[model samples]
Target: MEGDCLSCMKYLMFIFNFFIFLGGSFLLGVGVWVLLDPLGFREIVAANPLLFTGVYVVLASGGVLFLLGFLGCCGAIRENRLLLLSFFMLILFIFLAELAAAILAFLFREHLTREYFSRELKRHYQGHNSSDVFTSTWNAVMTTFDCCGVNGPEDFEDSLFRLLSPRTMVPEACCQSNGFPGDVSVEQCVSGSATFRRNKGCYSATVDYFETLLFSAGALLIVVLTIEIFAMVFAMCLFRGIQ
Candidate 1:
């Protein structure tokens, strides 16, 4: 009975680690795709320091998961105490790191307010004509989301964009039209026309976008963490049962 239970535990460990291996491969593929995408993804990520850092984090996480999965599989199959212990230690370290990160995020949540982002936008945002990365990124964001400044057109009142281009109330990306081309004249957009200017702010649109992304990522994270816990438990059990 004891031998049968040990065999069962060993197989369970293998199955769980195999799943983790597949998940890690998927994450690694995604990270590589984003990094090497021929489209505008690389450019967009490069434009933002935070986004660039996130890409690297994704890559590192994928690599670590891949390594952990391999270690778990090998340790279980060979019933190697050293490998099992290493796997447990690594998982514990990652679990503790995640906890620390979560605590820090919660502590700093209040600082990530709209007012803070608005101030940053006002300080660094150049006009539409500027070819800088920040300007281009904002143009792309505004165009993609069909929204204007952080809090709408009013936010640009004292912006550098307004100071630089006094005649233009908002970027051309903020304009909306009913025509085929859908490109309303900038004059109409700036003439206080309600239909021409998009009333929605980029802040809310960005929040919604990130919320959707985070929901998906959070689900995946929970699954991965659960698998890790199971892997750790099975690894320790098998390690102890081994002769």
Candidate 2:
């Protein structure tokens, strides 16, 4: 009976680690993709450092999970107490960190809303067609998402616009005439008519994009964390049995 239980625990540990390895690979791939995303979807979290930090955290955690999962598999198969103890400690640390992060995310979510994004974006907008990096990034955002200013096209017409480009109310990308695949200039698009510009703002759209990403990431983490906990439990059981 004792031997049978040990065998079952070993099998459970191996199976759990296999799933952990797969989950870690998925997270690692997503983190790398987010870091290299051409569209710059992470810009939505420009105001909050946590969201940006979360990306690196995901990558690091995935790496740890991958390595530790292998270690766990070996420990279970070989019935090594030291390896099992090490796996338990590492996974415990990760579990605590993830729980803390989740709590903080929940607490601060109210401050990271679309209104906050709009306000931050307002501070960065240099004008309709300025040659600054922020301006270019905003232009890319508008073009990619088919949006206008923060709240609308009129959001561009302000003290900022007066200081930069007095005549232009919106960027060329806001206009439907702006050619995305070609070398069309902002001058040509804005010169036509107001009817060509998109009426919707990018603030909501950008927020929505990041919100979806956050939700998916949170769900995945929950699953991975649950797996980690179960693996730890079974590992401890096996360690005790071996002793």
Candidate 3:
């Protein structure tokens, strides 16, 4: 009976590890998506150090999870107590680290506000004519998100507008309507009229973008953590049974 029970746990662990392997793959996919997402990923990366670090951290963790899941599968199938214990220890460390990160995020939640995004935007806002990568990225964000400046049109008042030769009110990207391709006149967009400018500010759009990312990542983390906890429990059971 004891031998039969141990045999049952061995297979149970194998099944559990398979699910863990799938979870690891999901993490890997999300990491790659964030790294390559064309819309606003680059903008976000250049804007905030904390978010930049978080992206790479998630990517690295996904890689680790992939390897650990393989290790777990092998350990469970072969009844290797050493491998199972090692897997358990690594997962425990990761779980604790995630918990710590969560606490830090909650404690510093105030820092993740629109003001923070505005500050970042203003800090990096180069002239519209600049060919720098950051400038281009910012333009792409503003154009794609259909937003202007950080707080509103006023945010750019201090940046590129100040550097303008004749002091245009807004950039072509911030215009409410795209001017005709053949028309080279700046009178339509740079006319210093409220009708030509975008009504929404980049600050709110930027906040929503990050909020969506956080929600997706948080959901994924919860799923992965739950899997890890279950995998740990099953591995422990198998290890004990084998011994």
Q: Which prediction has the highest TM-score against the true structure?
A: 2
Off by over 4 Å in 1: 33-48, 110-112, 177-184
> In candidate 1, what are the lDDT values of residues 1-243, reduced to their tens digit?
999999999999999988788778877886898788544455445545666776777777778888888888888888899988899899778767766756765786655677866786787788767888887877777877778887888888888877877877777767775555645466688756667789899879877766876687778777888888898899889989987
Question: Where's the lowest-lDDT run of ten residues in candidate 3?
Answer: 182-191
lDDT of each: 0.78, 0.78, 0.75
lDDT of 1 at 157: 80
RMSD of each: 3.2, 3.1, 2.9
* Per-residue lDDT of model 2, residues 48-143, tens digit only: 577778889889988888888888889989999999988898889988988898898799887666666566566677755577766676777787
TM for every model, in the order presented, reads 0.83, 0.85, 0.83
**How many Å off is the CA of 154 in candidate 1?**
1.7
On the 0 to 100 scale, the lDDT of residue 101 in model 3 is 83
Q: Summing lDDT over every window of 10 consecutive residues in candidate 1, give the lowest-scoring window.
A: 38-47
Higher-TM-score candidate of 2 and 3:
2
